[model samples]
Target: MSWGVRSILHGLDFVLQNIAWKPGIDSDLNVWSTRWVDGGMPEPVDFLLEEGFGFMKDFRIKDLCYNGGGRNEGMVRLIFKQESVDKILPTPLISTRSHDEVFWPFSDEVRYTVKSGYGVIFGEFFNNKGTLKDKERLNLKKKRFCKTTLWKLPGPQLWKILLWKIITGSLPIGSEFIKRNLGWDPFCTLCGKELKEVETLEHLFRDCDVSSRIWFGSVLGIRTDQNTFLELGEWIINWITYLKGQKENYYGLTHFLVTLNSIWTLRNNSIFRGESFVQKVFFKQLGSLVSLAIKNPVMKITNDGEGVFNSNDSEDLEDELNCLKDALLVLVID
Candidate 1:
């Protein structure tokens, strides 16, 4: 038994004690002896304990009410008062064929419910309120995002799904497709490099010239380099942890995630379609994507001590969001 149930029974032991089993075909209850009437004697028999009411040879307390009405009205009148008879007749009989059953008076239903039992114990104190903890309790001024918090980033389901795929290293990039024997070329879809490389998650999300341009669009004047592409998943974790602690980074990471999602989407579209992975298109798509996905009223717009976003800054923040999640996940696992 759970502590909730045990505590309930412990607190309401008296209620159980007062509950007497009604007689069935077997007639287990001694009607005169049982305490049924308002926790008092079942019947107000004038005779003492030495002199019983009478041998109830045929009828039983349980059989008294079989079909919503009492079969032994005369016998009931003989032992119990009009008030007692009234209470007994409409008691919603336990059984007709099987032996009599005992039930909690808290519920009219046959089975004891968890909600009823829970209510009996903790109804007054149970909290139905959500995870809305008081801010003063923790005194947390700024909401921070870390590796664990990344999974809970509330936005479009596709965004979260892609993120999960990225972290798992199962994203449908060219190299991943060929690894599964999907019979496809594993070359960069977004880059116009002379010598193409296998379009791995590392190449798609980072290292690609197109993606590098997106990062260059950030207002933070963020620069992408060799380190930015190494150990993608660990970098993400470090990226989040580092940014979370810095007031300077603030909500700047939002732009990063958006930029990553946009570049990936464009890369996917460019695989078969004629979608452009140009820096301008990336910035245009990102602004619209972030606005539609992140509709929360309290969301902050971070300015990285740079001028407001314009056409020139598009590449700075654009592909800066794209980073290798799956590659790092494999590295982390290895």
Candidate 2:
């Protein structure tokens, strides 16, 4: 085959592997073989083929839905595993009668694009080669935290990218430097010279005394030392998930991101500028950043096709700032 044709075919293979089917009337998609469910690659149901149910192998997704396009819960629960059922039921059918459409699940637009396709291919390349540690790679593929939580967060794009780097171990920290043989000291500089602990992502962010103090001193009142998760990625996922549940306005998440940014900045200053971690200065700067984030919150598109701020009104903003100030007041730094 010609090189051009061969390249096209190679790209097509990657496209097909990552694409998922969005059920409309669901008449065109085979339930057992099509990538109709979310999470990962689609596979046939794991049940043994029975005498009378051989015909089910050819069943389309529409067969499991009512004539009006609602899910046929009885047949779905009976035929598919509970895991499949859980994913299938929540998937909304098209309001009008239409054919099923193939979509790129990784992008917000749900349409195939060159950028997203390349991202999927690149991610898979590293994942297959075991470049990322096992638990981190598994969490990335399974949870899809970037698409689900990080991208949806209302903040500056830089802030989101920083969070992504931290989760993915893409930051140029001491451990990463050691891995690349850059001859930089890999020990936690924030923990001082006497302690001599290697600065892994977890230790720098969560386990170090300085970072732990920052977390504890924040308005969120998080105690990093009390974190139970073994993996830093998992630990962050837990807190982000909790923040999502607890706050409707996303103030908690915004504050959390700001605090993380401050901690990182503090670490950098300590390393590069020979600065010491001062509680008063750090908290003062953190409060200003938080206030700045509130005043200029991210803009989001509303259901009515209007762009609105993700922040509260002046009065509400004042109240929130006061609350944060009051909380910070209780945290005394010697």
Candidate 3:
């Protein structure tokens, strides 16, 4: 029995001691004459007295003992049996390797991601650390060209196009038939000048006295009446190259690109539309193109360095004013 129950029974026994409700040989003999240990108590697993030993609490009291008395003989026997079984069983051995090395589970995506991120781990194990660090480090300032929105293009591509345009201007010295075939001259329909080998692509676009006046007087607001052929072409290339460098200058870049596109469009219109390229009509169209370009994401120039732009703000007023003047003359009339 547990200690609690044993204590309660001991108290009951004390209360009933020496109480004679009837004669010793009368009803009391049948009631209290039979002792609890004689028949009512449970049998012990083993008795300390049978083993010829005195009760000693210190001698192999496995876990719990009931006051160093004979009451816990069964619990003591149980503890000794448990200790014997534990001694017969061997302890388990643990492996020295890490969990990943010894008990790794396979996962296709995890393995692929690791391999793709760092290449093969075997190479990393064998390669020099300094060499690996150098290969991975990025150096932005060493780049030859700034990134542009036009497919992340470099400045060299613009230089190539400008060079091609210059070469086309020198190709008219071949023959009279070649000059007429290449849209070089139509007898200057207005001035009736004898257009010959001197009338090249550059002459058509910039050198003609009529086109030169329109270009310098209105758009550039500078006198180009005495400007040389090389000077005008150089100016145009420099303007485009600078605009491309400042790609984030959306308000300015948009005006520049759209104006260039419109100028080419006007040239084509004069060649194929069968209409005289009047300066006033062309300027109005160029104005519309500039307005449309400002609203779109094309050169998204913002006042702040981050490139946030308002289509109608005085912040880019100077760029807009210059762009408007240049675009009107270059695209519409020049």
Candidate 4:
């Protein structure tokens, strides 16, 4: 490759797949070599780098993340200043547990964007250099949100993405709609609040009295307090952690995800359908969906329009298939 093409490709490679920094299965990021610090240069791992540690390989950021005492940490402290260590501390990481994950840095929903790619490759073509939005800001959100294993829950891929978007403030809520000059009333459609307090992720999911009741009455029985969790990302991580801790309730996480999705659906209903908020039916449907998810862990988590039924879960699938066939037959007849 020519020098420019080679540089562009190298930058593109970094932009395309190298940016997001989720702590996947044993996947640790170096505070020095990797771009973990957003738009900020890393403080030197001076002594170790002299020995060619970061350039040579095998060593990683996760190596420093261990709760175990001494050994590497002693060297790490000596090698890096307190200021350098501080940046890595608030990584929104719970390192000891979690499976592998891949996320796009452009959006919290992990939706990859060409704009993000351009910004990365062309060096702030779209944003100011060294600013929060210009660099690893997108990757930071990726790291926090990958903390949730909602994708492992039983649901359609799009539904999972929708919830992820909702949690990340990327969904087209009233606030976003207003940004596009869509003539939206910048308030809680449910509560009719003022423009300053629009139906944001916090409003739709937690702050709204209607959504709060859904959480309070559910099997999880947890209502989010903005005083405790200023951000939806924090609230979601805690929620997922709560569900994961419930060992006896294997379906707890699934239940939480399903119920949240239902709540969001109701929010849409209120907005688009002009439907009044109804709690009893929402609760009933949530219960049913949770049960259905337990029986079919792959309920709608696929994209090709086919639900994968586990061999152990073949019951009633034939009848459902037959019903689908009959519906298609009716369409053909008409």
> Best-fitting candidate, measured by TM-score?
2
RMSD of each: 28.0, 9.8, 40.8, 10.3
Question: Which stretch of 10 consecutive residues in model 2 shows the poorest summed lDDT?
Answer: 325-334
lDDT of 2 by residue, 66-120 (tens): 8866678898778876645644554556545587767766555567777767766
What TM-score would every model get versus the actual structure?
A: 0.42, 0.51, 0.34, 0.50
Ranking by TM-score: 2, 4, 1, 3
- Which regions of candidate 1 fall more than 4 Å away from where they truly are? 1-147, 291-295, 298-334
lDDT digits (tens) for residues 41-97 of candidate 3:
112224443553344322332122244221244553453343222211111111121
Q: Give residue 142's error in model 2 in angstroms.
A: 6.9
* Candidate 4 colliding pairs: 155-300, 156-300
Instruction: Tell me the lDDT of model 4 at 251.
Output: 61
Candidate 4 wrongly placed segments (more than 4 Å): 1-138, 141-150, 193-196, 226-229, 297-334
* Backbone clashes in model 2, listed as residue pairs: none
- Candidate 2, residue 228: how far the Cα is off, in Å: 4.2
Give each model's whole-structure lDDT: 0.49, 0.66, 0.36, 0.57
Q: Candidate 2: which stretches are off by over 4 Å?
A: 1-137, 141-143, 297-334
Better of 1 and 4 by lDDT: 4
Sum up the clashes in candidate 3: 2
What value of lDDT does candidate 1 attain over all alpha carbons?
A: 0.49
Model 1 over residues 217-327: C-alpha lDDT tens digits? 754344557355344543344444344434455455566666667676677567656555555545665665555334422233334311122224555334322322322
* TM-score of candidate 2 to 2 decimals: 0.51
What tens digits encode model 4's per-residue C-alpha lDDT throughout 22-49?
Answer: 4532455545555554234346666666
